[model samples]
Target: MADTQTYKFNVGMTCGGCSNAVNRALTKLDGVSKVDISLETQIVEVQATIPQADVLEAIKKTGKPVTPL
Candidate 1:
């Protein structure tokens, strides 16, 4: 499998807590390497070896709307 893959998300995280929430959720997934959240941009950039579907599920589990970036 690839070492790193980028997955962009349209996460509506309004505060630092929201960002952290999304970050932690993504970090807990199977093959995530790192997560970069931009509150200003409303985007959660992810680096992972896991599938996008899994990542999406994790994001959805946060109880916030997310879309591929």
Candidate 2:
């Protein structure tokens, strides 16, 4: 089973389209099972077994700020 991890991103994503941009970028990474992003709080909730380090890197690849919660 994959573990669910919640993260907060500091990127300035102001719309649903921006959310989709980040989602598309992160979802392509290996071990990422799911992603739920909130533009209001700039948070991303992910379900995956990948290491937090890899996750962070993947999020950065999307040009977003990601912090563990």
Best by TM-score: 1
TM-score to true structure, per model: 0.90, 0.72
- Cα-based lDDT at residue 4, candidate 1: 81
lDDT for model 1, please.
0.89
Candidate 2 local Cα displacement, residue 35, angstroms: 0.7
Off by more than 4 A, model 1: 1-3
Model 2 lDDT per residue over 1-69, tens place: 676665544555778877887888779978877888878887887777778778777777766555666
Q: What is the alpha-carbon lDDT of model 2 when measured against the actual structure?
A: 0.74
Q: Model 2 residue 18 lDDT?
A: 76
lDDT of 1 by residue, 49-69 (tens): 988999999999999888887
lDDT score of residue 8 within candidate 2: 46
**Model 2 misses residue 2 by how many Å?**
6.7
Instruction: Report the C-alpha displacement of residue 11, candidate 1, in angstroms.
Output: 0.5
